[model samples]
Target: MLHSSHEPTDYQCPFCELLNDQPFSPDNLCAPSDLIYRTPLVAAIMACDGFGNYGGHVMIIPTAHLEALYDLDEQTGSAIMWETKRVALAMKLAWNPAGTSTRQHNEPAGNQHVWHYHQHVFPRYADDELYRQLRHRVSVEDRARKALELRSALFSAEHPYRLTDTDVVR
Candidate 1:
């Protein structure tokens, strides 16, 4: 089924470019090292921008470039949700924040910046002001450090999700 796309005719999807290893553009802040979890169907990467006091938030996206929620398939959506849960669990183990939250935007009116369908997982604290605060670009070093933290917590012996061949990126 052909779905209507909101992107411009010459639009270049940053997520697709990043996933495909296409020519690097400074506009895309995501890096290979920022990937904390990935499978054949989906990937969870550290967002370059962080909200409020938190840094190293994660976004789970489908491996295939589906433009929006309306364009997503069941299998891919399930994969994204699975990764989102794992990332939330990892965040709890890693940071021990008060709680965690997941957010997804659909179109321009919904504040969806990227055309690709993705879900964000954030660690929330009492006064984090996640919605009120502006997003700022986190340092590359900080992102890498947080990625390591999440990766360690995600694959650690204490976590329920073990590193199986099916779940882990090889």
Candidate 2:
């Protein structure tokens, strides 16, 4: 068990509730690809509530149930960041976003609605309202397709990029 004072005794953490269940609700889970990216200590999946920006938006979460960043383990933290960067990179490559944004909220005062610690990675567009953008509710099938696309983008980006004075190629 995660040795954290913030662990909820009243109700289960929604992320922990995922427990790799059948992703029927696209907003709560991914149908086809549950976790697009997974390391030993963490997992990255398309958040069901990515209404703010692009299709490839995702959340990087620790596999264990930790309430806040302070409660997160070093190894889990590293794994989360690694997956976050990969997802952001893949979003850039696949979606051609104007930019990328990463957000993490802590505690009620900090607007952290969920108790589980996670990082949000979204593809920023020129007109995106950032925190003010209205989140679009998407379907499970659509999200699954997007997840597949992100995986492909990450796979394609896996190769090294070498630059020449005249040209750039892998």
By lDDT, who's the top model here?
1
Model 2 steric clash pairs = 51-135, 51-136
Stretches > 4 Å off in candidate 2: 1-10, 20-34, 52-56, 157-170
Alpha-carbon lDDT, every model: 0.83, 0.69
Alpha-carbon RMSD of each model: 1.9, 6.9
Candidate 1 residue-wise lDDT, 59-84, digit = tens: 89888888789987888988788788
- Per-prediction TM-score, please? 0.92, 0.77
Best model per TM-score: 1
Which ten residues in a row are the worst by lDDT in model 2? Answer: 161-170
Candidate 1, residue 96: how far the Cα is off, in Å: 0.9
**CA error at residue 119 for candidate 1, angstroms:** 0.1
Q: Where in model 1 is the C-alpha error above 4 Å?
A: 1-3
